[model samples]
Target: MVLTADSYRVLRGWVNGLGYSLDARLIPYLELAGFGSATLTQTFDLQYDLISALVERWRPETHTFHLPCGECTITLEDVALHFGLPIDGDVITGVSVIAEPAVLCYSLLGASPDDTDSTFSKLKFTWLKANFQHLSVNATEEESVCPARVYIMHIIRGVLMPNLNNNKVHLQYLPLLADLHNVRSYSWGSAVLAMLYHELCRTTKPDAVDLGGCLVLLQLWALYRIPFLASVSHQPYVFLLVNRWSIYPGIGRLYTVLIYRLMIEQHTEEGFIWMSYRRPEIAAIIPSSSYVDSQLWCTNAPIISFNIVEWYHGDRVLQQFGYIQYIPDLPMPVGDVHGINKRGKHGQHWRVTHQIFVAVWENRMA
Candidate 1:
């Protein structure tokens, strides 16, 4: 559906309500990225990029099943089981409700008994189909796009904290979301936004905030099938702060450099900045010798090597340092240790190992 004037107004209102400024340069970047004009599509595209970046892809291991007729696929059933839940029904069936994976996602996270077929829900279904259609499995193919895991920590830090200004809401979801292994297959962004509406909007002043408006914008983006890019072409720093850095230590260093760059650009005084793992305790449980040449204190505590970068004003040099944190005892098996242990048969005695890097700056004022 085309973005009407009314829809644009609602979308704009939500963006403003969320305390996120539509970066002035975003429109030009969208045009450069070949997204047509500065229309609803572009707006939706930006939101999509932010949401996609925040959520981790669900890449589940699949096994092929050969049937008498043909080949069938075995996929996770968690999403289907959770879709449009609490509304009595064996299976989801309705004119509006389709069996598409994305539709199921919207239903699980966005749909409710009262507003099952809301405007936003319909729009989100269309967008999900359009955006991910390329990854859809063919009747003959055994491969399928697995459901994604919601990075609850990212959502709280990136989206809700900036707007809600309350940690209580974030605290409530922390326990449920922290247990990554058991999280449901649904849209994290939609779930959090829905909770925001229920917790703050419904019970308190309705007009106090535009939480509903924000949800509508998210739904519209999903409906329009827009592409999301987390970073602007000129701003690589945007990429570092938002995207996952666990895989790239170099990118992590670059992120540290970017923070310095911003400080240098502004000619600000020396100050301290740092980044750490979302769950350091998880690292504590795993054996350290299983992965790399890292120092280990004991089997109980995992030593995490943290890459540190330092910089000084007026000098384009970055001093590098290494810092380590001994995470206390939290015993937990990390799969078959043989695969991770590099010491061969003797490696069986070793524990699973993991490392994290943190960027820090210290400024002394005289």
Candidate 2:
């Protein structure tokens, strides 16, 4: 059937609701995000198709593009360290672009071996620098960068100090608030969570890992700042959930559920609407090749990446979009173990059912 103007508009509206601005350029990326395949060749094509479309449409001549994480303060030293000595009154400190469900950045300074610990700082700096550019906070502006700093400072303060009368967490280190909004908190929080998760898997010490701590920290950051991500209907989390790792499915589910519960509780009506509409587009990012079933049973694959597919729906926003159900038992095929073993194909099949879920939320009006 021929695509109609109205139909095209509807689809375009669908894509924009996913987060891209309503423009022809974003169409290809929207399409790629929905394709599913189980082959490496297919994934490469999807990536290429979307990237090519963006490059062609935006036609960004400069090496740098606006970043989309958040605002922060970046010192002159930080800029120089990242991009080297000034070239023509400025140098490219970093480059950032949104890729599907997440923001990606490649910076010069943080690339150093010694700066491994500085990952979050670098990411935050890049996010702020990009946002500053977006807001036209040029170096020559009379208000200058200081005003911007103060602005972000206020936001950080507002988030951390929701109520001066009530003591929540220790806010003695108020200065760190600004740093937390950008990438620093997220990066460090992510790293800490990953390490803790790994430890949980390795040692089976869920009690010692403090899952709530990491979730609390991330939730606070996401709530107070990072509204863009917090606004998203689903947040992607990757973890191993295999028997060999001795990791229980419940451990993974708990963390995912915690994030959703806390985030939803914090959501304003606007946030809920934002998520409901965005769920489809975000859910569409699960590439066709990345099926949870195969990933679970696939051999020779690092179990981590496959697990990411499973946790994709744990959030409330996404969970609200869908439901999960578990079936306990089913009839087993009758056969002798030796006969089945000799055949090496199928003999007695044990009947078992796992959780089944669906996304039922309607897309918001565009």
Residue-pair clashes per prediction, in order, are: 7, 9
Question: Could you report the Cα RMSD, in angstroms, for every candidate shown?
Answer: 25.0, 25.1
Error of 2 at 325 (Å): 5.2
Full-model lDDT for every candidate: 0.24, 0.22
lDDT of 2 by residue, 226-333 (tens): 353344433333223212222643333343333333443444334423223134664465443332222111111100100110111112111222333233123121
Candidate that would win on TM-score: 1
- Candidate 1 lDDT (Cα, 0 to 1): 0.24
> Least lDDT summed over 10 consecutive residues: which range in candidate 2?
10-19
Itemize residue pairs with steric clashes in candidate 2: 36-288, 37-288, 37-289, 82-109, 321-359, 321-360, 322-358, 323-357, 325-356
Off by over 4 Å in 2: 1-143, 159-161, 165-174, 177-275, 278-318, 321-366
**Roughly what TM-score does model 2 have, to 2 decimal places?**
0.18
Please, what are the lDDT tens digits per residue for candidate 1 over residues 162-276? 2333221122223333223333322222223223223222213223323321332333322221111112323765555535653654444334334333432332122211111
